[model samples]
Target chain A: MEANIAVSSEKKPTWGGGGVRPFGASYGKMMMWFFIVSDALTFSGFLAAYGLTRFKFIDSWPIADEVFTHIPFIHGEFPMYYVAFMTFILIFSSVTMVLAVDAGHKMNKKKVTWYLFATIIGGLIFVGSQAWEWKTFIKGSYGAVKTTDGKILQFVNESGKQIALSDFVVGDRGDDKVTQTRKNGLWFESGESVGQYSVAQVISSYNANPSIQIRSEKIDLDTKQKIILSREKGAAELAKAKLVVEGANLEVNEYGNTIFADFFFFITGFHGFHVFSGIVINIIIFFNVILGTYERRGHYEMVEKVGLYWHFVDLVWVFVFTFFYLV
Target chain B: MAHAHDNSNVKRIWMVFGLLSVVTIVEVALGIVKPDFLHLNGIGTSWLNWIFIILTLVKAYYITWTFMHMEGEKTWFRRAVVWTAVFLIIYLVTLLLIEGGYLFETLAPLVRW
Candidate 1:
């Protein structure tokens, strides 16, 4: 490669060749920039397609706030505060990543290692938090009905207050609520597991209730949002009508439209995957630092490159947070 | 070209990050509150989105210009990459919008998937 470049240089003048180093850095940095641009386009395509779907389902689209409700330790329900916290963690990690690069500039191995370690831990924590969120989401707190036409209808009381499925779920099935099963029932004696709640149970419960009336895509008279029954049904019906249905008119979703779930999983999942890779990369770089790779090389460009990647993750999050949580 | 930035330049990066954080917090608050004026008719296509897009662009600009050091690069070098990206993005958005409009038309019956 060096001989080729030397021969090519000896042959003729190529464009703007002003003492440019053949393979020192300029090409790598340019390549990274191109990669970032193309990657950004890929993400934009995903997000834009999401917007297209969202716009199509304007009326039936899931509310971002209501869908992603989980308060770290508080448990029961809180709006998007946990996600906000996660965003902060990621942004903070980006800060530490930058600091690592800064330490690299000073050839401060100890400081660089410390910051890189913190960044890795931060990335891991963010991934863990996202996993926890997915757990809560998949194992939905409250239950809703899956319509025959493939839409989810959540349960709200006569007072129009959202209620948890736990409030209505009956005596222990001991592991009956399962989605995927073995080919043969007797193939494996599956251990008793309190499986994730089902949308079907809510429908049957509502059907059995004498006072309970079904709420369709149409809105209730008073509250405007869909409810299990009319306000006139009152508390008596609310108590006896132990079923609630929720969700929207889309493919299949744990909560609402499958598109919402799809976008949620795809965007966050991709971001989480990036974080995981970032940690792995940081670990490799961390070991390199310990072994004095940069000290011997007399340059910390590797740290800077990794820092760019880390900040790029945070940059993606900034958009995800806006689209998913805000807009 | 070989010059190295000092502590003050690094401090400037921190300042930019601080500004970005502040803007993000404001975005969160707006999202949560969703003021009556913002939602007076409905939250669809309001001034808030404008604020968000503008602020987001500002943050992106700072991240690229400051942290990525695009501002320090040769004019032609910066333009070669940045302008291509900008134009390509605009072109893609246009295509998506047109395609989306067509899809919307067909989706009323075929939209179940």
Candidate 2:
């Protein structure tokens, strides 16, 4: 008991002197690491949930190549090319950030400033590209029908190439029916905006076209391609379509499964938000570097810290790119 | 941190960047081509998927070790950060995927197409 009392008394002074540094790391840096680890776990939870749900609907999941094929101002089907470009931009930004941190270590404010500026530009480009990608995805390339049983049926040519609704869906929509608003209809609140073509228009147009066949979402294990229905069966299935889906939303997706879009929006949006914040933080640090605050302090630890965060964001994108685009 | 400001360190950074870029290029090429041999099922997934996952891990390692300066940190600090995340992530992914597979089996008869 006396020894225990002595040990406790001896430990009090060290405890009062602002706790021990675990592994010689500063308090702020350690706290940042703790936050990062927890944040990483949260991301992992989301991705794991994505993996599980994807596994559950593996048979009907959208092909990543077909879904993410658009590039800005380009009309060709270049699968995974634009996404690879985005990944390279992010990784390059990470490189610039590390260079800035290295420059900061040598007290080279000029070098640090230039590198920081480059990093910020890279980040802005990446964010802009992401927005464009989102717009393309939401706008959709080909229109598909959602059956009453919640299955998506896409249109394809006899050659097995995908066909846009505009290719065969002829005739103008006669009515300009807008979504019902609260003021327009009693007890009705507007939700999402209406799609381009109505179900009736799509059905009639599909029936008029003989070359168009229905492609089911289920992939044939042998061919690794979606199963295409016969012309007669395609017409029969088109009769079961309840709604005309042109693009993706939280509720409906013209792309194979609704859950796939849900995960795509949630995961990529969350990562984009991180990149946005990292740019904001980098801007703040860039100003501090210019103001010579770190010069007076004799160290540019602020740059180093922010570099840590920026690198972390890049790391997460690597995984997101792999799972979402490549896989 | 002080020694990392040297010219060789800059070259090292660029080299790591090259390595990461090469890995990404390889991943993209494989994804685009999807070689017949690589597409064969192995264990639970295709060998191609396993290759992508492994390459992703390699990229993650370079980003953390070089860019984040984990190599400069003390041993315990590095372990504390890396080990915790690695173990927990592996555990979570394994169990969840198993559950997902089971759910697919249960729902197989009910769902159409």
Candidate 3:
């Protein structure tokens, strides 16, 4: 023992082990913060790119209210209600996560387990809600016609109320035009969208219904509304119709610009993935808590580390909500 | 660690949650109603958009400070993370938005995009 003491006394002191931690942070905690900082920059790059695209297409960007006015089960228009609920759920989860950290600090295993469990549940629910939103967005509500110049043309009634192509276009096109695959004849094909109403059917049905007017994708900046063409102009524009577009895809969008859908999917998809991984990490830590790992280790710094990440996700959501939904 | 045994920890968490909820509700209300003056006036966008952005920043602040426990960290530590992020993000956003605006001004007149 005297030999060991002499050896320890002869050793040089390290920074953290000697209680000389720079910034009063443990090495692990400091590293986690650094990771968060870099992760935050990645998200900022995406959001700023989104902003850039939005600014570029400011005039024709889809009105958010018109696109995201969905609430499951309870039909009818409730703009921002569902998303607001989602925001509350995420914030509540964040609260639970912070509570878990607080409980961990007190070394109360039971409270920590309960709070962490609640946090996981909240995360699962949020992810599920996001999936539902994506489904609705992908399936779309109304369909539109694409012109030769790639302009999307939708329909509104005489009173300027938006109408779907299905609202008036008789489903049966009464023609037997099969999809042209690459093997059919030419070396290439247009990759025609099958099982959809043809442009001719939509245009003919549109002409038959005089009450329907064409709404252009272009928004009048001063009004912030899609431009509704006059009946004559609507007929003229209908003559330029090439294909029918429904829902959203990389090449087309029923909700105005395709880039809008791209950013929506990309940004929210990335955030959702973070939430998912956070849940997995939370589960592992929850098991650790049950096993008394932190209690045995003398500190619940792991819980605190994960808590920082959970809150960071919530923080990003706040900005995403503002930019994508509200602004 | 200092607040470990203190009952104030739970109280602070709930208080911040309440504040965040109220702000979100106010934002939703404003978004739904969308007063004409707020939507119509402003230079680049509108007053309503500015309000949303500012309120979003406020929410971000609370989430970072209290929920993320950033305020509890040493001052220099917090600065190293926050200042670095804020500066970089602001620089990128300003330049990208300006570039996007320039493109809009130049290309929009010629092409429909």
Top candidate on DockQ is: 2
lDDT of 1 by residue, A140-235 (tens): 656565545555555555555666666555544443655435764556566653334543454445555534443333323233244354534422
Q: After superposition, how far is residue A173 of candidate 2 from its true place, in Å?
A: 3.5
Clashing pairs in 1: A152-A246, A152-A247, A153-A245, A153-A246, A154-A245, A154-A246, A154-A247, A155-A244, A155-A245
lDDT of 2 by residue, B1-113 (tens): 56645887889899999999999999999999999777756557888999999999999999999999899899999999999999999999999999988888899779865
Q: How do the residues A1-327 of candidate 3 rate in per-residue lDDT, one tens digit apiece?
A: 446442342354544344445788987788888999999999999999999898887778888989998899987778899999999999999999999999888888999999999999999999999999999889888898888887789899988888888899985765767667767676764775575688889988988888999999788878788999998998888899887878886677888888999999999999999999999999999999999999998989899999998899999999889999999
- Shift of residue B100 alpha carbon in model 2, Å: 0.8
Alpha carbon lDDT of each predicted model: 0.68, 0.89, 0.88
**How well does candidate 1 score on lDDT at residue B96?**
73
**Per-residue lDDT of candidate 2, residues A170-279 (tens digit):** 77665687667676656765577776778888888878877889999998877678999998888888899998888887888888899999999999999999999999
**Model 3 chain A poorest 10 in a row by lDDT:** A5-14
Backbone collisions counted per model: 9, 0, 0
Clash-forming residue pairs, model 3: none
Candidate 3 ranges beyond 4 A from true positions: A1-20, A178-193
User: Which fraction of the native contacts appears in each prediction?
Assistant: 0.17, 0.71, 0.81
By summed lDDT, the worst window of 10 consecutive residues in model 1 chain A runs over A241-250
DockQ: the better of candidates 1 and 2: 2
Assess the local accuracy of residue A299 in candidate 3 as a C-alpha lDDT between 0 and 100.
83
Report candidate 1's fraction of native contacts. Answer: 0.17
